[model samples]
Target chain A: SQQGEEDPQALSIQEGENATMNCSYKTSINNLQWYRQNSGRGLVHLILIRSNEREKHSGRLRVTLDTSKKSSSLLITASRAADTASYFCATVGFMDMGRRALTFGSGTRLQVQP
Target chain B: DAGITQSPRHKVTETGTPVTLRCHQTENHRYMYWYRQDPGHGLRLIHYSYGVKDTDKGEVSDGYSVSRSKTEDFLLTLESATSSQTSVYFCATQAGGQGETQYFGPGTRLLVL
Candidate 1:
C-alpha cells in the first residue's frame, strides 16, 4: 500500500520557473527520499532527508522534511525542459523485525514547457 | 541504473501461465527489492531479499514468489499469472546501511492477457 500522498497530481510550468511538490505520509518514518523518472526509464535518486534533518540541498534541488507534520516537499529551482518527468516520494518506515522498506507515493508529473 | 539490470524488458503472456522475471546486479548490494507499478497505485513492493536465500514478503506478495540464490541475482516468479498482475516491474538495490540510497533498474513491462 502507498504510505505517502503527493499533492497536485500534475503540474505544468514554463522554463526558468520553479516547481514544488508536496508529499504527506501517515506513519512515522526513518527517512524520506525523492526520486525522478524520465519517460520509459528507471527512477533516479535525487535527494534524501533523514527524519532528524529539516532541509537538504543538492544542486538545484531542495528538500524539506517536517517530521512533526509527517510531510516532505521537493523544490526544483529554475526548472528546465529537460526536467520534465515524474517525481516520487518514498519513505523508509520504522523497522519491523529489524527490517525496513520504502513505501512510495503516487507520483507527481511535472511538465516544463520550453 | 547503478549496475542493475532486469531481463526481458517486455513480455506478454496468457493468464494462468507461469512467468519469471530476473534482476541481476553487478554491485553486489546486500539488499534487493521487487516492485510493481500500476496506474494510480504508484509502486508496490512485492518482495525483497536481505541476502542470499534470505527473502521476505512485501505488501503484494500473495501471488508472487522470489528467490535469491546468489549475491547478484534475484528472481520473481508468478506461479499463475492473472490479468490484474500486468504491470511495469522494477528492481532496486541498496547497499547495506540504514537510510541509504536505493538504485533502480530499467523496469520490465509485463502484460498478462
Candidate 2:
C-alpha cells in the first residue's frame, strides 16, 4: 500500500504556463513534502507543508494540503524549461506505533516545452 | 548541499556476487536510510539506522542488509545480488524528529547481470 499516490503519472506544459500536480495519501500524516529530481540525479527538497498549514509558497511553487481529504497539490506558476523534472510527494505519517518513515509517491514527470 | 556522498555512483555486477554501497555524511545526523527506486514502485525503503549499530528492516529488505558502525558512514550490502535487485539505490538522512525533511544523496545505479 502506498502512502502517497500521484495522479497523472506524467505531465507536459508550455514554458510560460502553469502546471499542477496532485497527490493523495491513505493515512493520517504529520507533514507532507515535495521534491524535485532531474534525470539521473539526487532529489532536491522543494517544500514542506505541515498538517496545520493549508498552503505554502516557495518562489513560484505553491503547495496546498487538505488533511480533511488526505490530499495535496503542487502548483508551479510560469513554468520554465528548467523546471522540467520528476516531482514527488512524500508523507510522514502520524505514528500509530512510534514508527514513522517518509513514504514517497511514484511521482509525476513534468516536461516544459520551450 | 547536505554533505552527503554515495560511492561508486554506478556499478555493474554479475548475479550471485556480493556488492556493497557506501553512504557517508558529514552532517552528523542520527537517522540514515537506504531505499531502492524502481520504475513503477517509486522509492521503497530497504533499511534504516537510528543510530550507530541500531538498524531496522524496511518495507523492502528482502535481500538487502545495512550497517552503520560510525556516525558518518552507512553501508548497504547485497549478500547475493540477483537480477531482480537491479535498480537505483538512494541514501537519505533526517535530523531525528517527526516531520523533519530528509536530504538525499546522489543515487548509486546498480545493475545485476
Candidate 3:
C-alpha cells in the first residue's frame, strides 16, 4: 500500500529554474526520504528528514518535513538538464510493526529543458 | 556508492514457472528489502529481512517469498509466475538504526509471459 502521494505528477522547467515536489502521507511516520531515479536506472538516495527535523539540506537539494501536516517537500535549486528525472518520496511509518518498510509515492516526473 | 548488485538484470519466464531473483550486497547491511515497480504503482514492498534467517511479509507479499541465508545475500522467489508479475524488481539494504537511508541495487527487469 502507498502511504505517500506526490503532487504535480509531471513538471517541466527551464534550466536554472527551481523544481519543487510535494508529498502528503496519511499516517504518522518515523521519517521521510527522497529518492531520484533516472531513465532505466536504479534509485539514488537524496536526503532524509526525521520526524523531529523540519528541514535538511545537501548541496543543491533541500527537504522539509512537517509532522503536524503529515507532508514533506523536496526542492532542487538551479535545476540542470541532468536534474531531469523522477523524484519519489518514501515514508517509514510508525505502524510498521518492526518491519520498517518504506512505502513510496507515485512520484513526480521533472523535465529540465536545456 | 554502496556495493549492491542484483543478479540476472533481466529475465524472461513463462507462466506457472518458478523464478528466483538474487540480491547481493558487499556492505553487509543488517536489513534487506525487495520491492516491485509497475507503471502506476511506483514501488511496492514485497518482503524484507531484518537479519540472517529473519524475514517478514510486506503489504504486497501474497505472490512472493524471500530468504536471507546470509547477511550479504537476499533472494526473492515467485513460486508460480504469472503475467501480472511482470515488472521491475529492486533490492535495497539499510544499516542499523530506524529510518536510516537505504541503498538500492540496479534492479532486475522480469517478464512473465
Candidate 4:
C-alpha cells in the first residue's frame, strides 16, 4: 500500500519557471524526502525535511512539510529543461511496533520546455 | 552516486522460471531496499534490509524474497516469474543516521513472458 499521494499527476512548465509538487501521506512520519527520476533510470535524492522542520532549502530545491495536514511540497526554483523528470515524495513512518519503511507517492511527471 | 550497481540490467524470462536480481553497494551503507516500478504505480517496495541477515518484507512481498548475506550484497529472487512481475526494479542504500539520503542504483528491466 502506498501511503503517500502526490497531487498534479503531470505538470508542464517553461524553462526558468518554478515547479511545485505536493504530497500527502496517511500516517505519522519521521521524515519526508523528495526524489527525481529521469526516463528509464533510478531515483536521485533531492531534499529531505524532518517532521519537526517546516521548511528546508538545498541549492535550487526547496521542501516544506506540514505535519498537521500530513502534507509536503517540493519547489524547484528557476527550473530548466534539464529538470524535466518525474518527481516523487517518500515518507518514512514509525508504527507502534517500531517498524519503519519509506512509502512513496504516485509521483508527478514534470515537463520543462525550452 | 553511492557506488551502487545492479546486475542483469535487462532480462527476459519465461513464466514459471526463477529469476534473481542482484544489488551491490560499495558505500557500505547499512540500509538497502528493493522496489519495483510499474505503470500507474510509481514505485512499490518489495523488501529491505537494515543490516546483514536482517531483512523484512514490504507491501508487495508475496511473490518475491530477498537475502542479505553480506553487507555489500542484497539479492531479490522471484520464485516463479509471471507476466505481472514484469517491471523495472531498483535498489537503494542509505547511511544509518538522521537526515541520511538514499542513493539508488540504475535499475533492472525485467520482462516475464
Output the number of the lDDT-best candidate: 1
- What interface-residue Cα RMSD does candidate 1 give after superposition? 0.9
DockQ of every predicted complex? 0.84, 0.70, 0.80, 0.70
lDDT of 2: 0.91
Best by DockQ: 1
Q: TM-score rank, highest first?
A: 1, 3, 2, 4
Clashing pairs in 2: none
lDDT of 3 by residue, A15-96 (tens): 9999999999999998899999998888998988889999999999999999999999999999999999999999888887
Which tens-of-lDDT digit does each residue in B8-98 have in candidate 3? Answer: 9999999999999999999978999999999878899999999999999888898899999999999999999999999999999988675
Model 3 per-residue lDDT at A77: 99
Which tens-of-lDDT digit does each residue in A1-114 have in candidate 1? 789999889999999999999999999888899999999999999998988999999999999999989999999999999999999999988863245578999999999999
Off by over 4 Å in 4: A96-100
**What CA RMSD would you report for each candidate?**
1.1, 1.5, 1.2, 1.5
Model 1 segments beyond 4 Å from truth? none
Ten-residue region with minimum lDDT total, candidate 2 chain B: B94-103
Candidate that would win on TM-score:
1
Clashing pairs in 3: none
| Colliding residue pairs in candidate 1 | none
Docking class of 1: high
- Cα deviation in Å at residue A109, candidate 4? 0.7
TM-scores of all candidate predictions against the true structure: 0.98, 0.96, 0.97, 0.96
DockQ of 2: 0.70
Q: What's the distance in Å from true for residue B21, model 1?
A: 0.3
Better of 1 and 2 by lDDT: 1
What lDDT score goes with residue A68 in model 4? 99
